[model samples]
Target: MLKRTRKHIKQLKRSITQSLNTPGRPTLPQDELNIIERIRKAAAANNQNNITRTQAYFNFYQNHPEVHWALLAHLVSRNAGWNMTDLKGEYLPKLLTDQEQVDFFAFLERGNWLIFQDAYPQLLLYEESKKQKRPLFHLLDPLNISKFMKPFWENMWSNERKEELTIALIINEQQYIEKRVIHNTHYKNKVLDTIMFKLQDVLDFNHILIPYTTPLQQKTKLVGGTVHHFSSVEDRITLGKGLYDLLFSVQSRLTQTVKWAETNPHTGSRKDYWPDLFNDVKESTPGQVHELKSSPCSLQVKASRIYSPSLPSVWKDWEHNKAEPGDWYPNKKMFHFVKQPIKQLSGDIEKTYCETIEELEMAAFTKNTFFHKK
Candidate 1:
């Protein structure tokens, strides 16, 4: 009887342990786990409030498991250069403060998991396709141009002012504006939830307000004057020059902004000689980007159809969109609602754009066709 009782107890224990083990928690690899632990430590050292950084990791790992170690390794690599001892005067107003930047570095490092979805180990790898493709400029009507260019611009700048200037100009030229139209949140905002006071300011600037809006009824209010969609194939000379002027300025100014990184010829690693992520007005004067690249007014919008098929009736709003607060800005996303391969136009300088709409169209597609926070 005693032997039989011991056997029963052992079997019962085995069954319980097996139930508990059921591939619990979908753990990352040991190396990946170690990286996450190090990131947590790094985040804490930068700030006691490493909550945001932690959550970003949690979210990434929850979904993508394949590159977890690669991502973690990628993140730890960024800690290689940051000089954290300096504070306000040391690193401020240029690259975030030592603490803020360190914290961000950690966060982004952990974000490697998401980034690893593409090029994992190299920064130079981005936009290789864009570099290979020699692109042409366009002055297609402002709204269409704005719609296409907005995401590209947003991807390249971090400052709200710079982004705003770019967006306003794009919209002004495109002659249309899109409000978030629906409420949504940025990643940081969602993690902080209601505790974030900045949420108010972000919402004011980022969210579109429409009290009557519902998922059932997608609605938006266009804040600015809407440019009529161009139907005329007649050369839109005024527009072509305007677009070229703005784009050329952006490219020139931006190039000047990032020039230091390219020319300084630093030794060591990226983090080691990271010449202040960008320069300031005081440290070095910004080169002028306002120069007209060509005979400004001579530029014309070359269209396939010289005579517009007659633009449809004008409306105050461009289109209704369903957007959320979680979406990131300084990033543009387009959803296709119209099925037609709609054609539009823009041009400038001596190039006269491409000879046919096919070339022009191809040029526009090729230009700056990459995205990320530059």
Candidate 2:
């Protein structure tokens, strides 16, 4: 173990030395700088909100289908939008104070924004490389992408190891946010370490749902796994791999899920997939407790649709502070994250999601009633 630790320390020292000696933005040619500017503008324009980011990912995937990670990011971004709108949806407003909701939204928004800003440039640079018929990922350094990604992108350009590239991106982005958001003192106190965040585990809320239509039946179904511990980077990377496998490893799922995304433009509402259970419009008056109309056993909606607002309806575009500067590539240990075996995933979680909603409604209703009585 001591020998291994020494080796790791040696690797870390080499990585830091390489990073410190890396060239800065001044070295890039004027033409490459122009391309980088265009890429930055494009990323900024699309990074406005969940709606724009989700659509951008889909469009990128359509154009460059070889980048499997683009599609995975699209699907995952959809879930992030749904979670954002959920803050103003039927149940959460009852349970959280206005400030708490705002903090939670900020937490979600920062991570979403950071990932897109970090990743989208890499995507666009690859597109440029294709146009020029030469590898241009060296421009990634000027764009402020993680040094960890440049080599992966270079290797991908040469070898086209799509899955490995995807896993590398997962590690890079997760580490990108670790210091800037997850462990930051402010977010730790305000969002991550709070009871409300803890309640996510109890409620099984950290799920990345991929909505896809089955081929034979043409039925829309939810297939995803839950990440119980969001604070752990390893768990999040594992979740990304599982989701990627579920979407791409299965031929039927890959084709159909793409079809589903093509058909349903994400409106940041659960209604996009299960319109029977969720509505983007506000159906009930504010602060009024309504009886739960959805049945967990039969998965039926008997009454008015639960309010699930679209992204724009509840939240505005966030102008994020510049991401803290640094690369997250620590050592060769990160390669293990890319090589970890993909777990066999069972993509059936619809019933459990319904039950979670029911529980949330009950909790909100009880809180509302107790407050009124007091």
Candidate 3:
């Protein structure tokens, strides 16, 4: 028997009944436990949009007594060839209906569904069990089995169809068992947040096009279970390009005018970013040093500096200037042309991330996952 905190159990009971209408207050079934696990994975993978729909899919499985789905849940646990941890594999099935049996055998031939979306073909999206279990839901009469078959599904089962069926079976079983499942404190992090963080760990956000709280259709290159991680140079170039495009677009907005220094001068006053200046100046007063007012300010200093198409934009890869060879010269000065115009740019580019876009996620719980409660 699993234990829950008093407060959690109360909410748990309510969520169970409201969602599934389970008779009498009872503990979760094994399928419900597994559903919790699946939810954890889906959340971890940054697939929150599928969360609600999937829960609904599972509830339908449990409620529709006509569809026996107990065996389906069991199939999801098998290791077989596909990696279950990564959610990639062929799902297991049991042919209770005559049509299902026929369709199942047809898969032995070279028949499969044709997918059109631009996505990783070899990369398995989700994994399911290979060995099937017995059905929990059965019809009142034996003859009703023939009527349940869909014409399309009845034609012939392809490898893709088999995989789809496995997915369906997992969802169906959840329908009945979901309400019984308890999320508990196991929900250590927001699913969407976790997904985003993981993606960041692998690649930059600009590289991935996952919209918040939505089904993801990413075009990726996965070698084995891992994505083909781009080189650091590639990531920098991509990020720089995205920023350049955005900055340029905003510059063209023209609601506010923007102008740049006439030369390749470092003028933008970086707020709180000044280095420790080596002051070799002889001061008249120890504490009261005069603010060396040199020409007051530069006229070109503006609110924002935007990269325009006509502007000579150089990649300016960070390379230090070569050391100068010196002859016997008297008091030769080295001048640095830094455009220091205070109040030149907005007070730091305030970055904002929508809290509503965040989601709950799950993982095995690493040491870095925990933090002191603020």
lDDT of each: 0.25, 0.83, 0.20
Per-residue C-alpha lDDT of model 3 across residues 256-354, encoded as one tens digit per residue = 111111111121111101111111122223222122222112213222211111101211112222212221111111000001111112211112111
The candidate, 1 or 3, that scores higher on TM-score is 1
Which pairs clash in model 2? none
Query: What is the number of residue pairs that collide in model 1?
Result: 18
**TM-scores, each model vs. reference:** 0.20, 0.91, 0.16
Error of 3 at 193 (Å): 3.9
- Report residue 36 deviation for candidate 3 (angstroms): 22
lDDT for 254 in candidate 2 is 86
Global Cα lDDT for candidate 1:
0.25
Judged by whole-model lDDT over C-alpha atoms, candidate 2 comes out at 0.83
Off by over 4 Å in 2: 1-26, 294-297, 372-374
Candidate rank order under TM-score: 2, 1, 3
Candidate 3 overall lDDT versus native: 0.20
Per-residue lDDT over 56-90 for candidate 2, one digit per residue giving the tens place of the 0 to 100 score = 99999999999999999999999999999999888
**How would you encode candidate 1's per-residue C-alpha lDDT over 223-305 as one tens digit per residue?**
11111222111112223223323323444332332232233222212212222221112232222111122232232432112
Prediction 3 TM-score vs. true: 0.16
